[model samples]
Target: AARIIVIQKRAAGKKWGKIMVQWHPLLTTSIPVEQPKGQGIKDLWEDIRLPGEGYYFREQRFGNPGQTSMKLTERVIIAFSNPDDVILDPFLGSGTTAVACKRLNRHYIGFEISPEYCKIAKARLLAEKTLWD
Candidate 1:
């Protein structure tokens, strides 16, 4: 069985309590913690951020074994890229990343070895409607 764990919030300083979250590959079950010190994208390590930085969408039924959360992909893409930027996804599982890029008006190039996922991604991309449209 596949599973994911998330640490949703943390308490701030010793005297004050403020909920805080640090964007990363995994979220733990910690508490109101200290606020992150840097911009989210700037905090990316070696320009790479791990997946499952947020909720894992336990309800999702379509994905490969290692598929990342759509919410996480969207957040990462938006933080690290712009409307005109060309996003590249080598895995292209279920096409979440490509769809996110289209929704955000960013161009994308993806590659997927699996035919099923490729079909899904193609259909998703073809069915995508631009925000302005």
Candidate 2:
């Protein structure tokens, strides 16, 4: 299994100014257990399987509870880009783009809306050990 470090915090007080942090591996990627090809063209996605074993993790994302993590977004970036390549995500929900880039060996910049989500995104990126090394 591949390990990922997780950092969590709670917004405190009425202003939510105080935050405490804890670090650990909240999740790990297991070796893909199965292979399946769902409908339509597979796009540029190779490691991401569609509605089966390899695809099972898609649902863990922020908006799509059953879809997958922004981590998959990292895999896509890695497949298409080189280290230090500039990758951008216009709607950077949950900072998935930045987090994934940290893991996939790329340089990325993104924009996200929610302040809380930004915290999570930043935490995710900061916790990552650069895949480049």
Candidate 3:
């Protein structure tokens, strides 16, 4: 589900308590699969391979899963959003949104549920300069 909200400058550190979501787009593909009658294993995915560091950030500079691959994020942001546009990711994770925004000239704001993730996000954002420059 994806929802885009366009807003003029928002107050700093002020959280919008509750938001009423209007639309939710289905995120699954149209692949037919059967489910068991009882509580059992569900084959939601046909193949599963444990991801390595490359899967997350593609760099060992920071050994963290929360930080996504900068290249991957940059590609997605460039594809979906444009420069100077407001992009929001409720689950910010490791500040991937911020890094991509910085590189693409877009404005982004997001929140991380875990303080650890937040720290990781901060580190990831800080590390962007070194990676890009």
Candidate 4:
């Protein structure tokens, strides 16, 4: 069963939304089998708040303009993948996705175009790794 989750965000006086598609891929056979019973994620999520300018703001501390919520990323990772699954993140930004993947025991391949952001991501990833060690 595939599900599409829509996340709406309003920042900098502009309204934008992101769509997350979740589906189980059949790696062995073409025939689809019954998926394991589990709680379903709602199509619309409104609880997670975006990071903003505040004294306590931490998600965007790396200065990534497009940074997202860590809770939101972890929820998506938990809903769509299992332990040891490989996740590809084209735009790593501050490495939120990779950090979440590490916390969830999933492997991740992240790419960041900016050298500064890459350093930030590596630092974050290392911090996350140290927590588990």
Please give the lDDT score for candidate 3.
0.54
For model 2 the local lDDT of residue 65 reads 32
Rank by lDDT (best first): 4, 1, 3, 2
Q: Which is better, 2 or 4, measured by TM-score? A: 4
Which residue pairs in model 4 clash with each other? none
The list of candidate 1 runs beyond 4 A from truth reads 1-59
Q: Candidates' TM-scores?
A: 0.57, 0.49, 0.49, 0.67
Instruction: At residue 6, give the lDDT of candidate 1.
Output: 32
Pairs with backbone N, CA or C atoms under 3 Å apart (clashes), candidate 2:
58-67, 58-68, 59-65, 59-66, 59-67, 59-68
State the TM-score for model 2.
Answer: 0.49
Model 4: per-residue lDDT, tens digit, 1-133?
A: 4445555443433334744332212121122222358445555666654443332245446787677678878867776677888989999998999999999899999988999999999988887753549
Candidate-wise lDDT, in order = 0.62, 0.52, 0.54, 0.68
Please, what are the lDDT tens digits per residue for candidate 3 over residues 1-133? Answer: 3333221121233235755332222232323222235342222322222233223322453444455456545644654565677878898876777878987888988977888778987887777773347
Report clashes for each candidate as comma-separated counts: 9, 6, 0, 0
Instruction: For residues 25-67, write the lDDT of model 1, one tens digit per residue.
Output: 3432322123347433223333333333333455454667667
- Which 10 consecutive positions of candidate 1 have the poorest summed lDDT? 2-11
Point out where model 4 deviates above 4 Å: 1-3, 8-37, 51-60, 130-132
Q: Against the true structure, what is every candidate's RMSD?
A: 11.8, 15.0, 15.8, 7.5
lDDT of 1 at 38: 48
The 10-residue segment with the lowest total lDDT in model 3: 3-12
The TM-score ranking, best first, is: 4, 1, 2, 3
